[model samples]
Target chain A: MNPKPDKKIPALYGGIIMGLISAIPFVNIINCLCCTGILLGGFLAVMFYKNNFTPGTPPFTAGDCLAVGALAGIVGAVVDTVLSLMFLAIFGDVTQQYILDLIRNMDIQVPEEFYELFEEAMRQEMAGFAIIMNFFFALILDVLFGLLGGLIGYSVFKPKGQQPLQPSPPPFMPQAS
Target chain B: MLLRFFSPTFLIDTVVMKASFPYIVLVCLAFIWCIAPVLPPMLAWHVSPANPLSSQLYTWFSHICHQVDSRSLHLFGMKLSVCARCSGIYVGFFLGVVLSPFLSRRVSLSAIKWWALALLPMLIDIALDVLGIHSSTIVTRVATGVVFGVNAAFILTPLIEESLEKFIPMNWGQRKQGVFYESQTR
Candidate 1:
């Protein structure tokens, strides 16, 4: 695009939205919709980009979409990690209790060792912050889904049939014997 | 006309099969493989309650899903690999893949926005129930999830097509014609 829209602000806004939606309890179910909520953040970023950048200048390319999406993804990862950890800190034990209850209902015979392992793992995850797991999940899911959302946004936002410079074929000439 | 969409070639090759052939192949296979866990989990549960496959499915999906029994659909007298809403989303994604070809490959945000719209009722149902606004049902969850998932397919199929174009400039014919020539990734 000929004009510049400060890209970072919109992307950060979008990423934050994605992260909060993905991290929140109950609301996080929206990710069940094939990460629709997360991708929407990326889509929103592109929408902001389009609105700010003059339309039809260079046209928003897929590359632009990916960049915006990626920025949103990175921001989303940070947000998701912090929020998930915080939420886990507050409700982690309760959530685990619910899981235990469900296991009893299911009547599955889990060895005592597994529960011990799970508890130990959880404690470690909480204590160590498990930034690696959170960051990895966020990075993969955010970038991929965000890129998709950007593409959808592109389809919706991009002006249609506006290829202003189609090369014309040579004029037809009659052949002489 | 629609039959062509279901033909073996269509299933095998996909929309614009010849364009960005490699990316399409890779993405489709990867997605299929990723979502393939649902069935195995059920089978494992049937075979042995604590079967490895079933346990593994639970362990992995637990990160992504709530996996509460009440919220999940039961098959073979056992809980599914994931919650009901989640199951609906996955199944709906399959349907979306089926329907994508019939839909316009239009690059319209409106086309993509429907997925969010689809989720409104589900979100409302949950909020209402949680807040004691009203009670929500499992059906509500699954139905809303399906709507979101199906719409997602509409967005995704096109994205895959677009991504391929962006990544690989050459069409199938061009690649085939120049097969023996010095090739470059770009």
Candidate 2:
């Protein structure tokens, strides 16, 4: 158990920084990299929390992991949402049109009977979903990834002496004051 | 009283853990297999104006990726619901979880600092894509996924075990209660 009262602030700061790092353009794309950064961020939070806890505090618990994970998810989600909005605004329509044209060009082998339906299908599918569509998907992914990250972080960075039934209560318990 | 209530859960968890390792891998494989077929329609459904079902379906995967179509996989007749990287992630993750219990001592968490090296494939893939040097083929994407999945599984199981040990805070008496219940049921 750590005796530091100020450690919580640093943990929060770590979470915030991690969130921002995940939100950055391009770098944010690395989230797909096994969610390495996000997981690292969650681990950072546990590291901070561990340092802050008073001596004899129970080593990091699943509950702590979950909390940290949730924060990382929220952070990643916000950044992802913003990026989605931008991606939607640009290149989306062009992409849809490009696919439609490509399919049309490939129509030589395509069934003459099914050609019209196929074209309609491509057009409708690409132009269909709204900005909010992208928003929600980004949000859920970040949360799940964050939760996983938090768990990993807890495992790697958690303090020693945290076994179940060990019951190492904090050193400075308020003595019925 | 608390011990009695929890005894069943522990017994069940232990039994399932011991019995289900191989089955879990199959479950993971089934999940991976399904993704390839379901993805295209789900993606097209989101972008198709004619399909009123698209919006709700789109909402389902919204938190994960832009689902912008190009950044996603094209399976059956359309793009997958999630982005390419995500598809790899879940497929990999499930596989990793399934494979964890069977690993030899060489692959155990404590011995393999090389697990950290697992992050490199993904890093290189994304970096190459960023530089316009290359696009990750489906096979490469999946390969990276498998690597990440293995690493994640290795890291995850131990952490989960540790977390359970801490959060549940069981005593020997508690553990014994579970053991006794299992014996009695048998």
Candidate 3:
């Protein structure tokens, strides 16, 4: 009766959660943990669905894990971008001021020309256009990294006895059967 | 009143030592030690008015750091041990973990296939750069680095998880021992 297959809802939720986490300041390196979070979340969702919906049956497959991974990666990327921006906006000026002050206190002998160039660059960077421009580039890098992480998460933390078999079965399996 | 909430959080932190230790190790090895050792020689080589080791240091760093002029911190003069993209990835990894519980919990490293899609972008970029069809820009270098870095995390996370899981008492120990014993007996 429940043959209409779908893991979309859980996948989306899992993805969003993962994405938001990836956006966090320090904890995001758990991305170093790669898709571990997404896979775990997807597994949690499917397990929850199974436990709550049906008593003792596991309805997980490698493909399900893969799907969850993709979703989480996307969500994580989006969250990370927003978080970086929020942090940048909040702290960027303060950080710049501190750095400039520290340099001055140390009495570092910076050449006049390079100092001018550096100040100009910083000013441009802080300007509306430059920050936005860098953000766009950063977004691309982030998404690709997140996606790769998600895919790897699927590979590593896939549920026991569940994962899309990357290598196809040999041609003669039917004959043996 | 004080004991009510603080105890549980304290206990949770105490129990999560395994989870936190690696990061502590990473902080020491990846950032603290890493930044100091490579920087001095690099700086002395690059910007100083009269420096003897500049050429040697530049050549040495060339193998390790992409050393593209733009994404570098120009002090007395000379790029850091790594390029901007490489630095970004490492620095990102180093700095992006302040909210580990909320952020770490949201994503799982295992759900990703980091290495699977990497071949094409890596190959095309490196080959083209070598062939000189187009110059390797900072953006392109970063793109490649991100791909590789993500893939690296995929490989590393499982090793960490497996190690962590081992600290907990799970019934699989008997089974693991049995398999090992059987193989040795055979």
Candidate 4:
């Protein structure tokens, strides 16, 4: 039986979850672990999809993982863009200053122009560029991480072995006395 | 969780896609790991400020690492792309790859737990620092990072090998050669 369960909804849910998590300020710290947060989103999507699907259909494949991950990543990128804009608008200078302060505490020396460009973006003079950059980053990162997560999730949750299709009840046969 | 590493059906799938070889990819990643740390210092030494590559690497890594100068190793009087901890992690990954051959030829899923265990000290160190119980310095950070990184290497190398090695295509008519391989192993 073709188990054509809709993969889109699950992927959408995953993308939104990842985007929201990545957008938050302090909470984003969880991502310090190799973007595992975004990867989880992808894994969860496949889990959700698998849960909803009936058994006795073609088992899920890596190609399926790629599709779901790509969808989620694309959606997550858009959601992330909107959230970044919102955060920038709301926090404005405080957020800018915080990042600048962190950068200043570091010991590295950089060309003066690089600092100027970063400042320009933080000040919103380069708002459009910043948004575009964030969009691309999220899009790329989510897709790659999502696929990897999907692989991990599949391994974790995959059924041990397809229960041998319940042996068809012994074919009803009339036994001669 | 580690049991997930060696699922038989997963191996079957790996045999089919036959994309890039895992060992080759690992080697490439190892190269990148080595070079990523070295790039910043090298750029500072030779590349002009006007060069986009010089600026690009700094900007990209800034988002990922704190890149604190005092906490990073210097090459040619320049800071690394990441802080000392990150540098150790990458270098550790290289060591992990080298060390993996000595540990096991088959994918040993149980080793994953050890990798997580190795990471605990770093987490504890960071937590204590954040709570103001104690502050960590470059030495503490890099040392903890090395422990975690070394174990992480063992976990990752086998994973990459198991998940990806079978993807290398066989000579023509070699599809399903796995059935024969499976029987032989049995």
Best by lDDT: 1
Scored by CA lDDT, what does every candidate get? 0.68, 0.57, 0.47, 0.66
Span of ten consecutive residues with least summed lDDT in model 3 chain B? B96-105
What TM-score quantifies how close candidate 2 is to the native fold? 0.56
Give the winner by DockQ: 1
Q: Write the per-residue lDDT of candidate 2 for residues A1-177, one digit (tens) a residue.
A: 443344345445555655566555455555544455666666676666666666565555766776767675666566545654455466444444565578778746766667677556545533436435544555565566666667666656655454322111111212332
Candidate number with greatest TM-score: 4
lDDT for model 4 comes to 0.66
Runs of candidate 4 exceeding 4 Å displacement: A1-7, A29-33, A46-50, A53-70, A90-94, A99-119, A124-126, A151-155, A158-177, B1-20, B98-115, B131-134, B158-186
Model 3 CA lDDT for position A55: 23
TM-score of each: 0.65, 0.56, 0.36, 0.68
| DockQ score of each predicted structure, in the order shown | 0.15, 0.13, 0.04, 0.08
Candidate 2 chain A weakest ten by summed lDDT: A164-173
Judged by DockQ cut-offs, the docking class of candidate 3 is: incorrect
True contacts kept of each: 0.13, 0.14, 0.06, 0.00
- For model 1, the local distance difference test gives 0.68
Model 4's TM-score against the true structure: 0.68
> Which tens-of-lDDT digit does each residue in A14-70 have in candidate 4?
888878877777656556555657877887888887787666667765556556766
Q: Model 4, range B33-68, lDDT digits (tens) per residue?
A: 568767766876887644677667776665456676
